[model samples]
Target: MFSLIYGFYKHMVQKDEYCVLILGLDNAGKTTYLEAAKTKLTNNYNSIHPSKITTTVGLNIGKVDVAGIRLNFWDLGGQNELQSLWDKYYEESHAIIYIIDSSDRERMDESKEIFDKMIASENLRGIPLLVLANKQDIPECMGVREVKPIFNKNSHLIGKRDCMVMPVSALTGDGVDEGIRWLVDCIKRNSYLRPPRNQEEM
Candidate 1:
């Protein structure tokens, strides 16, 4: 009888956990975005300045509880050498945020190439995607309208999952709240299909 009650107590105290992946090319502001997100979602988090946040060669993790669900973010490195390691995390991710360096027009093609690979993967089927056009604070940076068409060309590979292209400036922390709220809601709606992990499973 005691064991039964203990199990029930544990279950009530546990929160559903979801894993989110942050992927993009090097200097696409992936780390900056991660930091901004942490500061936004978690109360009183002192975020590192965007200029001081360097490239991630491996991963930077942040856990934040939204409502009752816990989101675990794995911010991976974006260098050419690191791109190959992204797929290894797909099997565990519930959603993906693909950061785009909108200010750097030259690397758009290269970014698309990598993004296509992710969309083509069977492992990522049904996983939600959020494309954040970083550096929107720049005077000449591409906006959501321009960035949309570039990724739209690969729509064939996206399947019928929830995907959105939004504008954000990690440096200035604009649009971070809306973007994260959307992601949280999408994952909740999809939780029945891909159920979030429990404490032990995560």
Candidate 2:
């Protein structure tokens, strides 16, 4: 009887879809990460070679259903010119996953600058943020400890938001699952903060 009621509730309740924006500087493994995630979650299970994944020219979208929740990822282009277009999608996004190239020490400062500006946006206030310290598979790559402190100064920006920095290797898919799990949990807990279903309501 209990099992029947739980089944009924699962069937009757509509699954919530959340819009997530994937942002980072060029060559930060944003596209690779997206493709890797799709390969793992969807039936299309083709292998994705990260080395062959070129820079994203615009947006590459992919959807995956996890534990009955649909996650729509907008993998935006990370080139310098494309950065200006990011704010256009900000109001619609429920969460953010910012990727950083852990191996590229020279660009860390540049990445932090862009991150600071993003978190300062009024439209993104209180939104959940997950920072992926990507390229952990590479030797000599900066780990979470080394890269996290750079954003520590701007911690106040996310004081009211759910934020986390996690180490991940987009190439090998290590740590990606754990990071995404945390993000899903955060979104579930704060579903009220999501954008309205219809634009008319906004």
Candidate 3:
């Protein structure tokens, strides 16, 4: 029954598609990152009111075709009340992108807790995760070295989960290409899931 729901979810997404789940804390710039990428690619963007940014309740789905890949990008709202929705698609996701504000030193512990939730979720185990240490252009931003320690602390439990962290400045388009390319490469490498068992035949 779950597989059936997953198949329907895939079909509803897009034909010949790859789905990516983008997660982060509130004010982590998840929406801006997606919109900025779209603007950079198309050279045009429709501005959304700042008030709308505050309430991205539930999820915002974006469809983009990059290098022949039909990508279904899901931007999940970080509000506490909306977090339960994240579990519905965790098993269906091809990869997970966890974004964090590199300049927010005060929120590092909270960030770690959210990441821990993602890692602890059974549906996400063994799946590839790409961490975006964003806001690198800000003066107060933490350097990549500073971020390394946090990542190292959580590295042990990530079995078969190929994770990578890259500094990104979504506001200025810095390091965005590397992040997107990493996701595309992960999908192209067939890293979604292992094959199913054939117990009857065995």
Candidate 4:
């Protein structure tokens, strides 16, 4: 009886772990968003000052527990050369968080181009996508309204999957909570199709 009771307790304590990808163009605030998320979701995590956070040449990884689920984020470098390495992690990922620097109007088209290409991949099909319009705190940043139409134009590519485009300021932590909550709910609902691993993300 003791052994059985212990097993039940273990089952209760072990969380379903999901791997998520954080992708976007360089300087689009992918790492900042990841840091902001860690700071907010995990207790006592000190976020790096934005000025001190340099461009990610390789990858940045972060793990946080939210709503009893463990989300392992593999934040790949967004530089053009590094993007080629993104596919290496996709098969293991349960979701994708594509960050966009809404403030960079000059590169909005380029960002959209990459987003479309990434979404068009067969490996990422049926996966939930959370598109975050980062750097919304900047007064000159493009509004979410402007950002939506760009992606929405390719709605056919986004077909039938759980997806959202949300405005966020990773620096200020605004919209992070709502975005994460939405993502968690989407992941749970889609687990039947792509079940989360019992072990931590590799």
Candidate 5:
């Protein structure tokens, strides 16, 4: 009886829309990471279909099917000229993945500004984030410890935020799978942590 009720609840009460918007400063390997994720999931199931990847001029779409859960990933082009366009998609996303260039020291300020702008936008506030310190294969690449404080400086989201900072090598596919799995778990459990909904008139 319990199993039947749980199955009914799962079918009726939860209609999930899983989406992730991958954002970062330009050349942060957003495209590479997407390809690596596709390859990783495909290899796990022995899928031979090649993923056709093109430069994400404005947006790139990648889909992953896992246990009846559909994950739709968007690769947003991260350039100053393209930044204004991101606001349009903020509300539609369930998660935000920020990629940073670990070896580039000169653009840290700009990257921070972009990160601030992301959550500050009217529609994106309260969204969870996963920060990836990419280019970890480089000898001069910055580690997660060195880059985390910059993301944590936002006091507005201190208690309400959820972020995972990790160093990854998109070239070597070192930490790509872990990152995706972390995102998957976050999406699945997002509503579990939210406070009780107010009983308001519909």
Candidate 6:
């Protein structure tokens, strides 16, 4: 009876935790997206303005609980100089959220180059990937369909991974929740893809 009670207590205390990395080029709205997600999930109405968000020099971390799962987001800086630091988190991340500035058409090619390099890293193999074409509120921003071709070119790079791209407006809180929901569902469905856990729980 003691053993059974201990097991039940352990089960009750175990939590579903996931680490998600948010990556994109500088000025792609990564920070805004992270803030928006936290606000939406926690119902923090006093959160700072998404438009007033500045470039992230290092990292902005946030936590949200959805459907009993705790998601820890790591929003890394996207400046040219900061790109080198992205791979440091790849090994520990269960999934990735790559944001793009849809209105910055001139940098689309550059973003694709960086994204290709990122997915090519062996550390990211089999990890679920969610790409957000952010800033959809901009009148001249590119839609998901328009940006799909750029990322879909090297299918072999992500042959073992699941990748999806969607349009969102981080500043306006559009599609952020749906994107996170899809990511969480993907993580739950692919149990093998999850990071290692303690053997006692397994």
Instruction: State which candidate has the highest lDDT.
Output: 4
lDDT scores for all predictions? 0.90, 0.87, 0.76, 0.91, 0.76, 0.88
Q: Which residue ranges in model 1 land beyond 4 Å of their true spot?
A: 1-9
Local accuracy of candidate 2 as per-residue lDDT tens digits, 142-193: 9999988887778788778999999999888888778888998988877876
> Residue-wise lDDT of candidate 1 within 19-123, one digit each (tens)?
999999999998888898899889999888776887687899999888788999999999888888999999898999999999999999999999999889988
Candidates ranked by TM-score, best first? 4, 1, 6, 2, 3, 5
Which numbered prediction scores highest in TM-score against the true structure? 4
- The positional error of residue 5 in candidate 5, measured at the CA in angstroms, is 19
Once fitted onto the true fold, the runs of candidate 3 whose alpha carbons sit more than 4 angstroms away are 1-15, 43-52, 191-202
The reply for model 2, stretches above 4 Å from the true place, is: 1-14, 195-202
Q: What value does the lDDT take at residue 149 in candidate 5? A: 84
Better of 5 and 6 by TM-score: 6
Alpha carbon lDDT at 85, candidate 3: 81
What's the TM-score of each model vs. the native?
0.94, 0.89, 0.81, 0.95, 0.79, 0.90
- Summed over model 6, clashes come to 0
Please write out the lDDT profile of model 4 over residues 1-202, one tens digit for every residue.
Answer: 9979977887888889999999999999999999989988999888788778888879899999999999999999999899888888888899999999999999999999999999998888899999999999999999899899898888889988999999999999999988988999999999998899996322
Pairs in clash, predicted candidate 1: none
Candidate 5: Cα lDDT at 158: 40
lDDT of 5 at 177: 83
* Poorest 10 consecutive residues by lDDT, candidate 3: 193-202
lDDT of 5 by residue, 39-146 (tens): 777646433232454456878888765544566789989878898888888877877889999899899889988888787876655666889999999998788899
Deviation of model 4 at 154, angstroms: 1.0
